[model samples]
Target: MSRFLFVVLPVASHLNAPLAIGQALRAAGHEVAWCGPRTDLRPLIGPDATLYPTGKRYFRLDGETGMASVRTLWEGHVLPVNRFIRDAVDRAVADHRPDVVVVDQYALVGALAAHRHGVPWATFCVGALELTPPDLPGFGDHVRAQLGRVWAMTDLPVDDAIDLRFSPYLVLGLTSTALTGATPLPARCVLTGPALGHHPDAPAFDWAAWDPSRRHVLVTVGTMAEHLARDFYRRMMAATAALADRVQVVVTASPDVLPEPPAHVLAAPRVPVLELMPRLDAVVSHGGLGTITEALAHGVPVVVAPIRHDHPTVARQVTDAGAGTEVAFASATPADLTAALTAVLDDPGYREGARRVGESFAAAGGAAAAARHLAALAARPIEHCPSGTAALA
Candidate 1:
């Protein structure tokens, strides 16, 4: 049994995959220790795992300053939260001294902790990023090239986290079987599908549970969704009105970020999406990997509205798979939302595509696959494992 230290991002979506992997590891008789601000995740792991609750913010993307030396780990700007995690690592290293450290992709603090000691660290990618095909043309042609240089500028030992070479580095992406021309990794990369743990238990929607006849549409901006999408929500509300008699719409927004919702819409605070996804007919969401994965996992189609960051990339993948329609952010007016959503809901192709993706993800043996690879990763010398997880079982 390995003593595993799981460092998860505090963000709600990122936590699910780690918790799922941790639970499976514990069930296999391994000791799992979690470090993060985990009040929201207590229900997922319960008393089975040890908690380290490092009260770091996990950094926000929009407004941040300072930390010029340690910026690569972040996809966006954030200083205070990064500093909190940075300081926490110093303390964690002197104490637990875990054998294996599994972390979320954005949580580079794991790299710092693991590198300083000899602890094996692997980062799990729970989201999507658009990377220009590695072999394509010049460096300028690669969309993700600049992101790589930014990553290498940091003080972390594995500065160039994206280098396709082998010989031990931070961040081993635990991806799915899609393997669709993804980056070639020198070290082992585990293709561990959608991590499934506990779906939040919430009261049934009155429209879906009570009426049972009305098709339900669930609309949500994921975590950080509300921050970047207030205008989108207002327009979405107007679109929801258009579907009034046809579909019962439940819309969620950040508590303080947006104004009141329209009367026709069921305005909810951030609710557990797991509970909501199972009952809904379709989801109107930002193209965050977590939201898309959950929607697809339940065989629910999506109307993907992408704004910034990875949303555009995720929207494209879902669209490519025929699981949803991508209403470009610049054109996502209420009429556009209504029309795009209608296109997704009316088409049988969308539903079938969602189920196909969902079934494939379910068959990938998520938590088990992750546990197998992590256990193997801890046992083998870091350099022994090849990129793309060629050496991982």
Candidate 2:
């Protein structure tokens, strides 16, 4: 059996995919351990899993948008987090002596640490931000420049040819071409769909309360953006009220955000989202990649209102794939939301498109496929690995 160490980002959306993949690896007889903040990892990973804590640090990107958001991500979050956890990751490498390290794309320090230790590593693409389109040459260059700056911090010699954000041996993209369209990816990149796994801490949902007579829709902006979704939730409540006879709405938010709801609507701070997806006819989302992919994986159409970060890109992909429609997050009116939701629900074409994407996702094999690739990489010698020279140098 091989040993695998996962260096993860503290964010929930980013953490979920790798968690699923790690579980898959462990089920296949491999040992798995995690490196990240203890406060966040403890509850999610539960008591049995081994964890190397890096303490806690907060990284907020509340009001930023567009290029400013990108700048904040690299300068505000990535660089600082790398500096904070660099020593801890290095110590984990030295102590654990893992055969392979699985690094979140955003956690560049993991890749550097693995390279320094001559351990093979795989890049886990948890979101669509790193999957650059051919037209966006400038954006790609900017990403390289940011990564270059991070590379310069070490005494190690610079190799401009290698993009540390992506592994030369393996890159597990948690998406399919059905959603990503025809965008070209790295030769080593594997599209492993969405890793839909069980959340042990998920709240118990009242399955008996669901009304099967009417069509159901789930309205959520995901975990991180709840503070920014109050207005959007209000608009959704108003819009869905008009279709009370034909549709039932489920909103995932606290009572403070949406205090009162109509008889046909269900409001809760947390819901069994994956368990509930199969029953949903349509989903109204903030265009988070995880939510969007999960919705499509279950053949549920989406109405995307992008907020920030890589949301706009994922929203555009949904629209381009003919599986959903998009609305402006800040400016969309009740009428606009109602119309978009109506279109996805009423049109059979949207459902067909969603099913097509769902089939492709099934073919991609999700976490099992990711585990297979990681195992294959582990079996190979370090001399044959792409980042092998970095250790020797």
Candidate 3:
């Protein structure tokens, strides 16, 4: 049995995929440990896997939005922390020498540290936004320039042909082409679909309270977007209120973030999404890849309003797949949200499209496929693996 260490970003969406894959690997007889913020990972990965706490909590821009905030996050948080994360990875490697390292695409330091130690590492693409095809350039010039600074901090020389975020050994994409649409991928790229993870401990949902006659709709803006999307949440609440006669809404938000909802809406800080997804007819969210794909996995359509980050790309993919509609976060009114929700819940085509994507996800293999790929890489040497970099067209 081989030992595998996962270096993941502190974010929930990013951690969920690797954590699921790690659990699968362990179940398959391989020993696995996670390296990240312990507090953030413990609850998700569970006690079965060991944890190596590395680095401090990430800086969060709660009230920030748009491309400018995106840039600030990259420059102020990600870039500045590269060296610290690299040190942490080195320490983790020294403490427990794993046969291979599995890295979240957002955690560049993991890749660099693995390379420096001459250990094989696989890039786990949590979201499709990081997968840059020739048609879809990976990063803009400004972003690439910032990436160079990150590379400079590392001991290994930068390979222009390979994106640092993508592993030279393996690239495990967490979404299928059916939802993301067909795009050219490197030989090492393995599209394993979304690993929504096993949430067996998810709280029991109050199903009896929901009206059987009305369409059940879930409204959420994801973890990062929750702080940045108050306006969007307000609009959603109003829209859901307008559709009270036609639908019953469950809006996920903390009491501090959102006001008390009308009788038609259930405003909770958290909901067991996996359990609830199958029961819902539609989802309204910030177009986060995790939420979008999870909804699709359950054959439920979505109404996406992209706020920032990779949300726009994921939103476009949803619209292109005929699984949902996209609305501009800034300009979207209650009417727009109400109309979009009505269309998705009313139309059978959207549900069919979502089911199609769900089929693709099942066929692609979820956490099992990802674990299989990582297992294969573990047995092989880094030099024997195929690698490529993403280039902007």
lDDT by residue (tens digit), candidate 3, 246-295: 78998888887787778888778778988888889999888788889889
Superior by TM-score: candidate 2 or candidate 3: 2
Candidate 3 Cα misplacement greater than 4 A, ranges? 62-69, 133-138, 200-208, 384-393
lDDT scores in order: 0.65, 0.85, 0.79
Per-residue alpha-carbon lDDT of model 2 for 1-393, expressed as tens digits? 899999987787887788889889988999999999998888888898889998767877476777666777788888888878888988998789998999999888788888777787899987788774423436666677888878776656666656788887789899999888778887589999998776876788877778989999999998878988888888898899889998999999999988888888998998988889999999999988899999999999999998877888898889988899999999899999889999999999999988889999999999898999899888876563343443211
Ranking by TM-score: 2, 3, 1
RMSD of 2: 2.5
Residue-wise C-alpha lDDT for candidate 1, range 11-98, written one tens digit per residue: 7777778877887888888888877776755666675657776774544445211222123224343234445666566467547878
Please name the candidate that would achieve the greatest lDDT relative to the true structure: 2
Alpha-carbon shift of residue 374 in model 3 (angstroms) = 0.8
Better candidate number, 1 or 3, judged by lDDT: 3
Model 2 gets an lDDT of: 0.85
